[model samples]
Target chain A: GAGVSQSPSNKVTEKGKDVELRCDPISGHTALYWYRQSLGQGLEFLIYFQGNSAPDKSGLPSDRFSAERTGGSVSTLTIQRTQQEDSAVYLCASSLWGRNTEAFFGQGTRLTVV
Target chain B: GIQVEQSPPDLILQEGANSTLRCNFSDSVNNLQWFHQNPWGQLINLFYIPSGTKQNGRLSATTVATERYSLLYISSSQTTDSGVYFCAVDHYNNNDMRFGAGTRLTVKP
Candidate 1:
């Protein structure tokens, strides 16, 4: 892919439903990141995945938020029992490596929990 | 955790005017980048400057690593430049990139 790509550009789910957001990173990139942005707020770090090593999940807001990256190429963010406060934009980004590399972002998925 | 701060939370400029946005971090960083989020919510990478200076067209950036601060300069601002500018950094040995609150720029024509 020429750039990072996210799936289901928009999602509307019930308050108690579960939603999954997917991200396809650029080819050969070794790093991936997931972030959340509420309306009128800055980007909030969610999870980060690097090549094969243990993922840094320190940023996940709660136990309901979890993510997985398979084969270091595609990634999925799962939000369980979505709440009204979960309505926001989910962004995905990728970089060549952790150090001294520029990151590119996807268009993002707007999740609306009704 | 490194603390990133951006000054002049909001800026209003007229077309053809010039401005500078600042970002300060609490610790040494191995990666620093500038991004612009347009009104439609697309984030575009502006620069990947951890240290030193670089320029591109009407935009330029400078980062003094030792000083732990970076500056983004916009020359001859245009209406299209109206957006939120964000500064993000990654600490040494830490890949968890953090972002500043961002500076909102409004260029009026």
Candidate 2:
């Protein structure tokens, strides 16, 4: 793909329903990241996967929010029992092996929990 | 965790006007990038300048790593330039990123 790709650009779900947002990072990128942006707010770091290391999940707001990167490429963020406060634009980004390099971002998935 | 702060929470400028936005950080960082979130909610990368300066068309950015501050300059702004400008930073040894509150820009024609 020319850029990072995210599936289901927009998702609306009832409370308590589980929703999975997928991100396919750029080919061979060594690092992947997930972020959430509330309306009119800045990006909030959710999780990060770098190579085969255990992901940095410190930013996950709650136990109900979990994300995993499989085979070091495609990643999925699952929000279990979604809440209205979970409504936001979920963003995915990938970068080269270095920490200082620029990362490419996906268009993002807008998730609305009602 | 690094603290990033952007000044001028909101900005309103007329078309053809010039403006400067600033981002100040509380800690040293290895990665500093600027992004623009358009009205449609697409975040477009504006610059990846951790240090030094770079320019793209009507937009230019300068980062003074020693001072822990960065500046974004928009020259001859257009209505289409209206959007939220964000600066993200990552610590030198950590990949965990953080973003500032951002500057909301409105360029009126």
Point to the candidate with the largest DockQ: 1
Error of 1 at A95 (Å): 0.5
Candidate 1 segments exceeding 4 Å error:
none
lDDT on C-alpha atoms for all candidate structures:
0.95, 0.93
lDDT of 2 by residue, A19-108 (tens): 999999999998999999998888988999999998989889999999999999999999999999999999999998738889878999
DockQ of each: 0.83, 0.73
lDDT comparing candidate 1 with the true structure: 0.95
Q: Write the per-residue lDDT of candidate 1 for residues B1-109, one digit (tens) a residue.
A: 7899998899999999999999999999998999999998999999999999999999999999999999999999999999999999988756777899999999999
Q: For candidate 2, lDDT tens digit of each residue in B1-109?
A: 6789998999999999999999999988988999999998888999999999999999999999999999999999999999999999989756667889999999999
What TM-score did chain B of candidate 1 earn?
0.97
